[model samples]
Target: MKSIDGISFKSLSSDLPAGLVVFLVALPLCLGISLASGAPLVAGVIAGIVGGIVVSLLSGSSLSVSGPAAGLTVIVLNGITKLGSFEAFQLAVVIAGLLQLTLGFLKAGIIGHYFPSSVIKGMLAAIGLTLILKQIPHFLGVDKDFFGEMEFLQFDGRNTFTEMTYAMQHVEKGALIVGIISLLIIILWDNPKLKKYAFFKFVPSALIAVLVALGLNYFFRISTPVLTIGTEHLVQLPAMDSWEKMVNQLSQPDWSAFKNVDVYILALTIAIIASLETLLSVEAVDRMDPLKRVTPTNRELKAQGIGNFISGLLGGLPMTAVIVRSSANINSGAKTKLSAFTHGILLTISVLFLSPFLNLIPLSALAAVLLVVGYKLTKPALYVNQFKLGWEQFIPFIVTIVAILFTDLLIGISIGLAVGVFFILKANYKTPYFFHKEQHHEGEVIRLQLSENVSFLNKASILLTLHHLPDNSEIIVDGSKSTFIDYDVLDAIQNFKINAHERNIRLHLKNIPEVISTNAH
Candidate 1:
């Protein structure tokens, strides 16, 4: 029940500028994700538009943008292959949307709350690191493929690392010169003092870099060995001259596959993985929100569902609330959902009217921008900061990072979570007994104080003492300071109660609270 009316026109104006910034950032992503998802590039742009517009209108988030995500690339790839046609894949996307909508209705927005803070931070840091590692090739001007594919060994037979090595081996001076110039401009523009220069302050640095790079590549004809990202990396618009051609590209769901068990399994798989990714992104984005706003998890699911549904219908890839775009929105200083909506509008309009122009943007420039972004995410400062927190936190954080670097996202997170749990358990093992006061023996009565949290681990000590108690002795089991008692030790005490009665040993249980129901007394 949040209303957009409360956000003022002045605020909207402020947000518009930020929206424009986000739009520029999202432009390449829309195409990049589409390229990653193996869907038509136009479909990716369409999803971006829908996510920006439709999801923005329905969303509870103030600044998050909905779009096809790099994370969903695997799902989309598998979906299309299984469905047999792009049209059929579109149907699945729609179905995924409906599922997300249902999740929102269930008030599942609380899903973002449960992730451990350490793991979440690690995720963002990992993504940042990954971005930096992946963009090096692009920055080097060797763009043989579009962005978003996670495989290190790309179809080109080079992984991210190999590509970097290859680029270094046969460097293109023209692409290199343009890239250096673009990087320099961005680095200089980021300066606090120089940033305030009104003439250059508000302009998008990435766009500038791209224009400069393109001009250098086109007119100067500097023959550097570096490769340039071409139209294949950019989004291509659907030939909309005839409605029939558009329909031909649209995918439909396979009703025949509906009866297959794999369909249900795939649906569930999509639901779970998509939900986990969405929840994780939502958590990360909220952390970036300057206003300290929180989103409802269920509402997010619904918005995602709606986004997926529409994207599928149009032959686009499925979407979630992506962190890269969300972070871009936050970084751009967006004030409300209007920012997301405006970006969507820009996406739609740009694809329709600016297709040719957008196509001219060099992939290297986009890679340069991403290079900066990735550096920020995985900056050495992040590691230093986490290390200062203590070894307990730092160890898991580093483990997660290394795991992500060597393996994939899910595996790395899993390992980090495991290590974190191990640390907790190890800490617990150091303290086995509590409430310590030595046993006291008066003329006739022996008094023993019970320890706090007398767990099974401590049972051996207490039980051994009980068995050695002198015959005909009067004993008092004092638990006056005990806060909690474990069940295994309780069983031992109850047995002591029985044995004491038979031994003609008078035993008194102090702190005479009736034995608390089923637990240790």
Candidate 2:
């Protein structure tokens, strides 16, 4: 048996370098996701820490990093409003975490297995596209809103297109100049000539670009021409007068909310959504793994559950196995869960030690990094490859992209799934069904022979055949001609047997037990 279920730390040193890389990438995302979610900035950091330390210890993934997910921003934002208080919402997060823990115990991770491959591909591509599109405004020094808002038009009445235009019109010369320079440095760092340079080879391109940009800002002392990330977008820590004060920042859920039916519904919603995102990410990360590491989904759920519970206790946002952070980890050459743990530790240390220094990091520089990240995701090759797979795949894939851009992530995916299911049914309907008439009586016996594979989509056609069969007719189902019969179809056939027996008709099934007698009539 192939074992795909254990973690080993044979090369802990390698993980540290990768972990530092992931930590740098995660810091901005943690803060930005928190801002997008309308939660306290520290909340995002807390979730990142919990995801890193707790989830990493428990999760099945070797390279995947969990944290406050951009996908859950809308849910958190709306949840706070609906729940009447942030503390109240924290309670919901706790419940949701426990629910996920229960789901893990139930081995419900199988749900991830059933998602159609095409849909998963479509989703990943769409996410990549969205990430690229959303990051462009930031790269150009347009800071009207935080990252990953679903609305093409933002709360400030500026659409993505408008933001680009606005940035061009009121271009901060300093910011634009620095951003363009940073972009050039990043591009150069990846160049064949510069890649071999000993100093540049191991150093991250983003870190170099950021350092150069920051140096320019300091040298010129230029306050104008560049849009700096203001206090509004920066991570904020709770006023820690003492240890007790810091703990006071954490909130306990009101047990009273449990009495309300909506609370349970919310809990289920979080569990389902969080589980889906985590499982999908696991699949994606596995596909990206150079070593072909397969993560256990049930263990992943438990990891995420623990992360979320700790997040809730500390007044942090809910956690999920986010693709963005996970991808960053993979691309950065992370080898083990140690990378995740270290990233969390970095998040903790930064807030505690180097927060003031972090404040110096230009939003435009971060934007430049994300812009590259986004481009990698939504590259032109993805579209071309998806299209080559044929219209059935292409249509849903394109629809998913459009729906995500126009509506939101969840809605767009639902729309894509519906269309995909329709196509499956249509294809099933076209499958030939053979009918054979009896040799003796007039329209008394008929035999139905199915194709190689019978799916649930064929249920309606089979049901219709059974419904309209003549009152005294005999029916025989032949699976010898079919390689595989769906469980639903088998159940339908068994149910028909009872009906046929009651009506004095014969129901015969071939290639199945006890369906026929050895003696001829």
Candidate 3:
């Protein structure tokens, strides 16, 4: 096969194996996200295909993978419930896509850059913890609810810890055995010696774990009826014959719902949350890239917009740049965006020809793979590294983890952001300006340097300094360091200049722009 774009055939070789791994990872996640969001199972699969093929084709990112995000699950579920139907929710997805497209054109993607590194790290850890907590039930065959609900309070009224308690009481022996074996296989496959072997290099640990789990389950079915896995403990894709039947399964949007005010509000909410999640995931993926290639954030937004648009048109859930799938792609040794495209192709092929085989794979195996993913995200080293950065960073990081674990993604992020802002404001309040005094032949010489960004919060301090300036002193007000000076501060400085002349204080201004006097006089 020829290379895509400028990527080499050698790269495609690596991408092919990585694509298989990602396809394996994306399958269960797509279904689970759809289940949690109250959308049709087919909707999530369509989104995975669109995100991989369409978004990967349009995206400037080489490694980031786009698909249904767990972060949007709550919003989607609530939207569907409020809109009264899946069709109406699909309409909202379309509107959200259009809104994201507008945001891309407006260059709103830069907003991602403003998020503190601590907060981003916290978000990553929070997702990791959420994954571990949510998957525990599935790992034990406690299929009471969907597999990918990240919220602490589930739709079924069971909290995260409570669900674990329930799962403990009703654990399936067969599923637990499969899950433990799969997790052990995954861990063993990560051995350095195994990685060095040519045969093992071509095989992804997750793929091996899944195959072994499937084999073990089958063996149990034939040999020990009592130990056989139940249907609910395994995947359950809808059986279909012919391409026509697959297409017939697709649901259409309710165009009449466009005029509803609540629909528009839901659309806006999805647009903002999806875009934010996409941007954050893009940032995180870029950091994880081995080559450290930077993704064009605005381009990513545009690509996600188109992906969501196409997915919504085909009765699919909303799409975003999902970190989980992207991380799997990167860790599996993917080389180019072609890996994502290949995964999309594989997803379609599996649905058409391999559904029965896929259905045979136990959910516990997938849960084991995700557990590994979660551990990687929340490794002890990361926590220790954050702690070493001092309390300024550590406080927000810990708070984000706690908040997300107790609440939802958006609320947790909002809390972390508020805390980060408090730190910034505190620092700003203390060091709004630099003042240095020197004794000279002509009385005291004072040099005042304004901070880079001086807002109204710094106005009082600046005013106080000006008021206390000794008479018959030479003072220099330097704005050279400042990029922005709030009008309130500038007005105060101007008033001081007038008073300085009358008080025999010589005041000099540097790099400070003249503003029109706002005084009525």
Best by lDDT: 3
* Candidate 3 residue lDDT tens string, 1-521: 57665345678667888888889889888988998888889888999999988999999888888889888897888989999999999898998899999999999999998888888889889888988888899999876787666789887888999999999999998999999999999888988889888778887888899899989999999998777888877887776546987899898999999789998898889889999989888888877788888888998888888888889889999989988888778878888898899899988887777889999998899999888888888899999999998998999999988998999877898899899887776666778899999888867899999999999988878888888888878999999999999998898898888778778999999998988768523
> What C-alpha lDDT do the candidate models reach, one value each?
0.69, 0.73, 0.87
Q: How many backbone clashes does candidate 1 have?
A: 22
> Candidate 2 at 341: error in angstroms?
1.6
Off by over 4 Å in 1: 1-9, 12-14, 197-201, 221-249, 252-257, 426-521
Clash numbers, per candidate: 22, 2, 0
Model 3's lDDT to the true fold?
0.87
TM-score-best of 1 and 3: 3
Report the candidate with higher lDDT, 1 versus 3: 3
lDDT for 421 in candidate 1 is 61
Cα lDDT tens digits, model 2, 1-521, are 22223444654545665677677667777776777777877788788888988898899888888988876777888887787777777878888899888889988888777655566676777777676676666566556686545456576788766777776776555566667888788778868787667566667777788788778666556554234444433333434445465566556767777676666676677778988889988887787788998888888888788778778878888989887777767765567777788888887777666767777766666666666666666678888998898888888778777776766666777887787777777767656367778676555678888878888888878877877787776788887878777777777777677667666677788884343322213
Instruction: Tell me how far the alpha carbon of residue 72 in candidate 1 is from the true structure, in angstroms, after superposition.
Output: 2.1
Ordered list by lDDT, greatest first: 3, 2, 1
Range of the 10 consecutive residues with the lowest summed lDDT in candidate 3? 1-10
- Compared with the true structure, the alpha-carbon lDDT of candidate 1 equals 0.69
